[model samples]
Structure formats: C-alpha cells, structure tokens
Target: MRIADIYKGNTPVLSLEVFPPKPGYSLKSVFRTLDGLSDLNPSFVSVTYASQGESTDRTVEIASRVRDEYGCESLAHMTCISHSKEEVASVLDNLEDRGVGNILALRGDIPADFSDDKRDYHFASELIAEIAARNNFCVGAAAYPEGHIESKRISLDLDNLKRKVDAGAEFLITQLFFDNRIFYDFMERARYRKIDVPLVPGIMPILNYKQIKRILMMCEVSIPAKLLNMFDKFSHDPGDLAKAGVDYAIKQVSELVEEGVEGIHLYTMNRVPQVREIVFRSGLREKT
Candidate 1:
C-alpha cells in the first residue's frame, strides 16, 4: 500500500522505520531483527540508506528483502551525497528492477573524508525534482517541526518544503519530535503556506537516558521542560527511567491522535520488544 493512500482512508495506520546494518555487520543479524519485528504487520516499513563512508549495498539488499521476503510495503531511503547524477540514475534503475516502488529522497550529510565540491546534490529539493521526472514510485520528503539544522528560520524551512512539493513530493514524514504541540504548530504553519500533502508525524519512544542526549545533540528538536524533568529525575535509575519514558510517549501519542493527525511512524531502532510495548500501552490498537 502507498502510505499516502493508507492515510486517506478510515483505517488508523502505523509504520515502522528501521536502519540497515552498518557496513561489515553480518546480514544474519539483520534478518534476525526483521523476523522479530515482522509480526507487528505495520502499514509499511522504511529501510534507511546508509550514507557515504558507510555500508551501502547492505542497505539496498535489506530494503529488497523487507518487501520480497516479509511481504510488506517498503520505502527505500535514497541519499544523494557522494553520488553523481549518473550514480543516482543507476540506483533508481536497480530499485525499479527489484520491485521497490517507494522512496524517501534525501540530500544526506556530507562525508567526513569528502570535500563539498565532490558532492553532486546539495539540497533535497533538487533530488525531489529528479525523482518526480521518473516512473511509478511514491516519493517522500522530510519535514522538520522545529526547523532544519541548515535553515536559519522556520519560514525559510517552509519555503524549502514548498520547493520540494512543487517538484512533486507525494507526502511528507517529519523528523522525530517529543512534544505534540510542536508538531501541531508545524502542521498549522504548513497549511498556512499552502503545502497540502499528507504530513505524517514521526514518533520516537524514548527507551533510555543516553538516547535522549543523543537526540538533543544530533537532531534540530527541543525536549520540553516536562520531558526534561522526567530525564533529570530518572536519568540515573535504569528501571524507573524505562517506565516513565514509556508513559510519556503514550501520552504524547494519545494527544496527537485526539487532534486528528494523519498517522504515526515509530522509529523502532530494530527493537521489537520496546516498539511492541509502546503500541500496546498507547491504546492505538483498541481505538482504531
């Protein structure tokens, strides 16, 4: 199923996002992880492309396996860093032949070893345009609720999003955020700017203290003071922290659904147990 179509109908939909194994990791482990999570029967699963300087072929192979072996819809992440136009064309052809029909187009981060001039596509909008000219595939682009790291302001980020939509993005999935208000504000702003594509909210259920810090440092998102307090109180206590983290995520998801958001994408991090717990407590399965 095209995820956009899933959102258009009455069935409440949920999807999973998984990263391909890093280069040199055994494919056996990746398959084991997939087997653990497959019974959830997500609306779809997205396999992230490892960028330049990371394992590349394994990512593609995992995406193909998710669709063919698992019998689930899959979206392959396509990174434009360190890839020439010709290289991108070749990858697209390979994807077509493999029966993969969905992609998340991104202008990935520059490699530590490569100079700026070595990169072909600097902006994701450019990649969106190129993919729009191609054959049958659902093209997705990223949205930032707070703002992108590269953009100076939210207004500028919205303008960048408009360019991608104009280039024919089918739908949008936002960067993971904790606060529901931030995502609601982003949706209102997107409507104000006349960008009408179905916008899916990315939900990350915080599983631990270290992961929270990593998110604050790496992603352009803010942790609300309430959530910060949760971390501050339980950051040192492993058992208590896990309980509080799941509760917080459940509340966040319930409120978002009450507000009529399009859908939710869980960043599973290849951990089936944690993802299953979140879905069970969130009351989403019963409500739908």
Candidate 2:
C-alpha cells in the first residue's frame, strides 16, 4: 500500500522505525525484533538505510520481508550520498523488483573523512525529483520541527522543505523532538507556507541517558527541562530510567492524539518492549 494513503483514513496511524543491523551483526536478530513489532499491527514499519555496502542490501531485504512476510506495509529509506546516478538507479530498481512501494528520500550525512568530489546527488530534493520521475513509489522526506541543525533559519528550512514537496514528496516525517509545542509551531508555519502534505511526528523514547544525549547532540534537539530533571533523578537506576522514559513518551503520544495529530512514528531503536508499552498505554492500539 502507498503510505500516503494511510493518512487519508479517519483513524490515527501508528508506525514503527527500525534500523538495519550493522556489519557483522546477524540479520536474524532483526527478524526477531520485527516479529514482536508486527504483533502491534502497525500501519507500517520503516527500515532505515545504511550507506555502506552489504548493509544497503539488507535495507531492501528487511523492508521486503516486512511487507511480504509480516503482512504490513514497508517503507525503505534511500539516501543519496557518495552515490552516482547509476548506483541510485540500481537500488531503486531492486526495491521495485521486490514490490516495495514506499521510499523516504534523504540527503544523508557525509562522513567527515570521506570526501568524494564527484557525487551524483547533493540535495534531497534532487533525489525526490529523480524518484518522482519514475512514477513508481510513494516518496516521503524528512522535516525539522526545530529546524535542521545545518539550516541557518527555520524559515529557510521550511523553504527547503517546500522544494522537496514540490519535487514530489507525498508526505513528510519529522525529526524527533521532546517538545510537542515545537511540533505544533512547525505545523502552523508549514500550513501558513501552504505545504500541506501529511506530516508525521517521530517520537523516540529516552531509553538511556548516554544514548539519547548522544543522539540529541547529533541532531541538535533540545531536551525539555522537566525531562532533563527526570534524567538526572534516574541517572543511577537503569530500570527506573527506562520506566520514566517510557512514561514520558506515553504522555507525549497521548497529547498528540488528543490534538488530533495525523500519525505517530516511533523510533523503536531495535527494542520492542518499550515501544509496545507506549503504544498500549497511549491508547493508540485501542483507537485503531
């Protein structure tokens, strides 16, 4: 199914994102994770891409399995960094052959040490336009509620987003943010700018302090003061920290639902228990 059609439904959409296992790790382990996630009956599951060699193939493999074996729609992430047009075409052709219908186009992060003078794609909008030319996939792109870390201004970020949408991104999924107000403000600005595709908010439960902190630093997302205090209070207790994190995510999801947000996409981080808890506790499963 086209992921864009999901937002057209009256009911709220719930989705999960899982990354492909890194090099030397067993793909079987991810299948076990998918088994648990599939039971939640998510609207779809997205498999994140890895720009490296074999890991890229694994992205297509996992996404195909999610759709074919798990009986759920699957969205595959495709990045255009350090890749030529031929390489991008090969990946897209493989996905199409596997019957995958959805793709999230990204201008991926370039490695600091790896510099390629000749790259076919520089921006995500260019990738989106290339994908649109095929007329084959439901394309999704990333959005920033707090503006992208590299973007100078939020308005300029939104302008870039408009270019992406105009290039044929059917929908957008946002970067993770702790504050819902930030997302709401972004939505208001997006509407004001007349970029009206379905914008799904991405939520990541704060599973571990170090992990989340590292992620926040990389993405430049601000941690809310209340959440910062909770993290400090639970710093010593792993069990308590996890429970508190799940509680915080549950609260966020509940409020988003009440506000009639179109969809909630959880970054599962390859762990099922916390995501399952948040989904049930937030009453998302009940509503669906």
Candidate 3:
C-alpha cells in the first residue's frame, strides 16, 4: 500500500521504521526483529538506505523481503547525497521491479570514503523531481519539526520543504521528536509556508538513557523537562526505564490524537513490545 493511502484512510494509523545491518553484521538478527513486528499489522514499515560508504544494495534487498516474504508494505529509503542521476534512477527502477510501492526520499550523509567522481546529487528535491517524472510508487520525504540540524535556519528549511513538495512529494514523515508542542508548531509553520502535504509525526519511545542521548547528539532534538524527570527516576532499571518510556509515549500519542494530528510513526527500534504497548494504550486498536 502507498503511504499516502495509509494516511488518507479512515482510522488513526501507526507505523514503524527499521534499518538494515551494516556490512559485516549478519542479517539473521535483523530479519528476526522485522518478523517479530510483522504480527503487529503496521500501517507500513520503512527500511533505511545507508550513506555513501555503506552498502545500500543490501538495504533494498531487505525491503523487498519485508514485502514479499512477510506480507507487509515496505517503504525503501532513497538518498541523493553521493549518487548520480543515473544511479538514483536505476535504484528506483529496481525497487519498482521488486513490487515495492513506496519510497522515502532523503539527502543522505556524505561518507568519509567519498571520492570526487563518486558524488553527484546533493538535495532531496532533485530526487523528488526525478521520481515525479514516473508514477511507479508513492513518494515520501522527511521533515524536521524542530528544523533540520544542517539548516542555517528553520525558515530556509521550510522553503526547501516546499520545493520538495512542489517537485512531487506525496507525503512527509517528520524527524523524531519527544515534544508534541514542537510538532504542532511545525505544522502551523508549514501551513504558513504553504506546505499542505499530510505530515506524520515521528514518535520515538526512548527505551534507554544512552539511546536518548545518542539520538539528541545525532538529530539535535530537545528533551523536555517532564520527560527528563521520568528518565532520572528510572534510568538505572532497564525494566522500569522501558515502562516509563512506553507510558510516556502513550501520553504523547494520546495528546497528539486529541489535537487531531495526522498520524503516529513509531521509531520502534525493531522492538515489538514497545510498538505493541503504544498501539494498545493509545486507544487506537480499539477504535480500529
């Protein structure tokens, strides 16, 4: 199913994201994690594309497995940071041939191994324009609720996002955020900026203290005081920490739904229990 169709469906939707293993690591564990989550009936699952130096062929292979073997719709991440127009087109054609129907276009990181001749495309808008020329799949793009870390300013990022949409992005999945208020503010700003695509709020259930810090370091998201206090109380207990995290995520989703936000995209970390608890407690399964 296309992500746009999922968002346009009647009931509130829940989705998950997963990343394929690095070059040396075995894919057995990764596939196990995805298979475990398959029973949850995710609206769709996303498989991330690696940066330039990494192996993206494996990523696309796994995405195809998720759809063909497990009966789940898959969204393959496509990046432009180090790929040429020809390379990007070839990858898109490969995905379409494999029966994958959705794509999450991105501007991936520039890996240290990049050589002068290897680098080509820069912005995600370039890829979006290329995808628009074909009707093979439903296209999705990333949005930063608090603003992209690389952006000079949020206003500039919004303008860039509008261009991506105008080029033919069907929907947007935001970078993960803990605070719903920031996402709400982003939605209003996007409206002012005339970005009218359906925006799905990315929600991450912080399962560990170290994980939270890693994400903050990587993405430049802010941690609210209330959530910090929860972490302070349960940081030592892995079990308690997980409980607090899921409880907190449930509260976040409840409030976001009350505010009538579009959808909740869970960065499930390939953990089914967290995803299950969030879906169950958010009162969505009952409604569905």
lDDT of residue 152 for candidate 1:
90
Best-performing candidate as measured by lDDT = 2
- Candidate 1 lDDT score at position 13: 68
lDDT of 3 by residue, 234-279 (tens): 8889889899999999999999988987777888787777877788
Better of 1 and 3 by lDDT: 3
Residue pairs of candidate 1 with colliding backbone atoms: none
Candidate 3 or 2, higher TM-score: 2
Which residue pairs of candidate 2 clash? none
lDDT tens per residue, model 1, 94-178: 8888888888998887666778766678888888889878857778999999998878999999999988888878789999898
- Please count the clashing residue pairs in each candidate, in the order shown: 0, 0, 0
Sort by lDDT, best first: what order? 2, 3, 1
Q: Estimate each model's TM-score.
A: 0.93, 0.97, 0.92
Q: By TM-score, who's the top model here?
A: 2
